[model samples]
Target: MELSEYCALDATALRELIRTGQVNAAEVETAARQAIESVNGDLNALTQPLFQSALDHDPDGPIGGVPFLVKDSGPFARGVTFTLGSRSIRGAVAAVDHELMTRFRAAGLATLGQTTAPELGLSYATESLRYGRTRNPWALERGVGGSSGGAAALVAAGAVPLAHGNDGGGSVRIPASACGLVGLKVSRGRTPSGPLAGEAGFGLIAEFGLTRSIRDTALLLECVSGPAVGEKYTLSSPDVRYTEVLRADPGRLRVAVTTDAWSGVPVDLQVAGVAAEAARTLEWIGHSVSPATPGIQPDDIVEGSMLAAVATGAALLRAPVRPDPGRLEAVSRALLAETLAFTALDVMAALDAQNRLTRAVGTFFTEYDLLVTPTLAQLPARHGELDYDDPGYSMRDWLRRIYQYGPFTAAFNVSGNPAISLPLGQSREGLPIGVQLVAATGREDLLLQVAAQLEQAQPWAGRQPSVFAG
Candidate 1:
């Protein structure tokens, strides 16, 4: 198979091709390798490419034999080595597959490589001292959104059909927006975090992957959604399969759309306009749409996220083999310092805020079936625009900076809502603007149905990044 042909197909199509013997798995793997080789140096998306391991992997399952990349960020896979995109940590190998990896394997995704994430998965920009900057495939000078940045870059560039990503505070969605891919952050507990921990980022993070199409997102959720054994959360499965929901009509219902950032920061006008247009698309599709905010407070996003982030950093820095703060980037070191002064009462406050924030969002659903907003406040930033290494910012200041750029996505992380960011609009300059659709907890079926409609209304499949394999 040609690299261009391989790059053109989504994971579902590739799976069908491999299964039907139209193209052998080995050939697809080779095309993927060549695609990676051609663009990875320019993009710096791969921290480690396991081409030989991929060759040896005899995948079998629903998506068997399709190329996939795991984020360096977490939910470990056995035998895979990771540095978590930090310079201070020595490389370590996982002893067992995290439950998510187990599901990925069971679904037949051939894990070919690891993508770069921000240090401790904190920043939105994938640029790090170790991995360097992971340039956007769409615009070489710009960033591909953080932590999941490299994954977005590779997948958008067509190096792989899909790649794992986790969102504690927009790590997946922001990058998906910046890179023009389908980023779905499943409801908390919809996917497992582990044999390692019950929850990642204190239940603020949801593990999933970035994809090219809504159907891919639907099928993937069907394959990976469900609780792992011994999980703290055991959400009941959806009444129907997610893929089936794509064809089902999402009944005309109340829809709420907001251009305002929860943080009360200014959203770029272009982005807000795109979000407004997306709401109009929803209205055109027969849903009742209105301008509305979820009534969630800024503290709901900032405090809830701050506590989760500080705690995560504290655990890593306090481990037996402690990570040296001197080796960390300016922002991560600031986070570590904040962890020291952190107190139990602070934890209580954060938890309280989480309760209030989640309650506020939950209450909004009483009036609306879904909410639409710009996935980011602005477009994909230029390199170094989100300076992770700048010592001028404190932990709170850093959070504020990130929240300014992407104020919409973090709230759902705190609220445990299922949110999907779609590349529904593009800039005149050609950058992708992500329009996010959020549904109440365990309502992914609703999200997918509407997403399917939006995908049809504003199709993005023909759009390709400048740095594509094709």
Candidate 2:
């Protein structure tokens, strides 16, 4: 297959072609490599190239032969450098595959290489001193949202069809919104996290990926989802596969719509308008849409998220190979110091607050089937818009800035509910505008059904980025 033809197919379509012998795995891998070489220089998406290693993947595995990129943060493959977008761990290599990585390989995905992430996956924008900035494929001057920014950029640019990403406070969905892709963060414990750390971001982080098509996301979710042994929280398996769920209709439902940022930050008019428009679309599809938000305070979410993040950060800093203070980013160092100062009582208080908020949001979901909101408070920010290195920056200032950009997303992370960002509209400048559809915890099936409905109603497949290979 030609590079153009290869780039055009999503993971599901590519898998079908390989299954039918219409195209061989090697041909597809070659097409992916050529596509990456064509655009990665300008985009700076892939931080490493594992072309030879990818070629060694099992060709007969399910969805086998599809080129995939793993974010450099946490998805580890044995022998591959696992830089968490920090200079401290530059030469570090994973001795074993992460559980998610093992599953990805087992499902027949060829690990092409690692993509860039913000240092320690702390920031919402993928601009790290370690690997430089990952620019959006639609506009070079704009930032691709992070910590899944590099993966989103590669997929948006057509360098790859699907790429691994994990979300703790909007890491996956933020970039998916910026890049015009499907990004789903599953309910907590729906996927495994083991053999390295028990849970990431104190259970706020969920492992997943960004894809151009909803079916690709569904197929991957089906492939990698399941509880590992001794998992603290185990969710019951879905009665039907997500791949089959896409064809089913989500009955007319009650959806709460909110343009207001939970943080009380003034949302950009255009962004809010787009989200409101999406609500109208849902109404047209026979769902009851109303302007209602969860009865939780923005301050509670901010505090809870910071508490979890700081604790997680402190734990990570305690790794066997201690990082040099000078080598760490200014914000990372500052946050680490701040977290180190936190007392046990303070940590417990934060956890208590998070649990309360989670329960409150859960209660709200009992009244509504889903919640609709602007995935972002505004359009994608310009490169260097959010400063993480300034010594004067406080945790509060940082939260305010990030929440302004991604107010709707972090709450779901805190609540451990299933949320997805769908590219439903575009700004006047032509940047993608994504609207989020959030379902109660363990309701990915409902979210996917609604998402597939939206995808069919307004398809984004024809939209191409400025840096696309085709």
Candidate 3:
């Protein structure tokens, strides 16, 4: 197959071609490599290339021969360098495949590369000193939101159909929104987190990926869902496969729309406007839409996140290498220093607050089937917008800035509800603007149904980034 033809197909389509012998696995891998070679230099998306490893993929497996990229931070594969986009742990290599990685392999995905992430996955923008900036395929000067920035950039630029991404605080969704892809953050226990740590970010982190198609998202979730052995938490299986659920009717959903920035900072008018239009579209499609939101205080979110992050930082410092302050980014070092000062009581307080907030947000869902909001508060920021290396940067100020950029996303991570970012609109400057759809915990089926409906109503596949592989 031609490289352009290969770049145009999603994982499922590519897998079908291989299954039917229309194209061989090696041909698909070569096409993917050509696509990456065509655009990765300017985009800096793939941080580590595993082309030889990918060549050995099973042609008989479900998505066998589909070229895939795993994020560098987590969801590790054995023998691959798992740098969290930081100089502190530059040479760390994974000794064993994490359960998710094992499952990805079992599902027939050809893991060919690792994508860049922010330092310690701390920032929303992917501008790490270790790997430099990961530029957005849509607009190179703008940031591709992180820490899944590189993954999103690669997928959007057509280097791959889908790529692995984990969301702690909007890592997956933020970049998906920025790069115009489908990003879903499943419920806390919907996917596994074993053999490394019990739960990431005190259960605030959820593992998933960014994809160009809703079916690809559903296919991947089906492939990777369920608990690994000795898991601390496990969720009840969906009534039907996510792919099957897509064909079923969602019925009339009671969706509440909110443009209220949780931080009290004003949302950009264009961003809010697009989200409002999404709500209108939902209403037009027979779902009830209203302007209502959970009363979540910005300070509460900041405090809870800080506590979880500090605890995570403390745990990282206990690792064998023991991070050096000079090697760490300024923001990371400051966060570590602050975490070191946190007392046990302080940690407990944060956990308690997170629990309360989760229950509080859960209450809103009792009245509404889903909540709609702008995935981000503003358009994609410039590459250096969130300067972690600024001499005057303070943790408090930095947190405030983060809340401003991502006011709508972190709450769902804290609540452990299923949230997805869909590229439904565009900014005047031609950047993709994503709208978020959030369902109650364990309701990813409903989320996907609604998202697929939107995808069909206004297809986003034809829209290509300026720096595209084709």
| Clashing pairs counted in every model | 1, 0, 0
Model 2 worst lDDT run, 10 consecutive residues: 49-58
TM-score of 1: 0.98
Score each candidate by Cα lDDT: 0.88, 0.87, 0.86
Which regions of candidate 3 deviate over 4 angstroms? 55-58
lDDT per residue (tens digit) for residues 115-228 in model 1: 998888888888899889999999999999887999999999999989999999888999999999999999998998777787777888889999999999998889999977
Tens digits of lDDT, candidate 3, 1-470? 79789888899899989899898988988888889878999898777655565723455667888998999875388878776888878678788887888888888898888899998887898998888999999999999998899999999999999999999888999999999999999998999887787877888888888999999999999988987778777797887999899999999999999998877888999999989988998899999999999878777687677755775687778878787779888888888888778888987877877888888899999999999999999999998888877656566667677778988998888778899999998999999999999999999999999999999887888999999998
Q: 301 in model 3: Cα distance from truth in Å?
A: 1.2
Alpha carbon lDDT of residue 343, candidate 1? 90
Ranking, lDDT, top scorer first: 1, 2, 3
Q: Whole-model lDDT for model 1 versus the true structure?
A: 0.88
TM-score of each: 0.98, 0.98, 0.97
Residues 412-439 of candidate 2 have per-residue lDDT tens digits of 8888999999999899999999999999
In candidate 2, position 161 carries an lDDT of 97
Model 3 compared with the native: what TM-score? 0.97
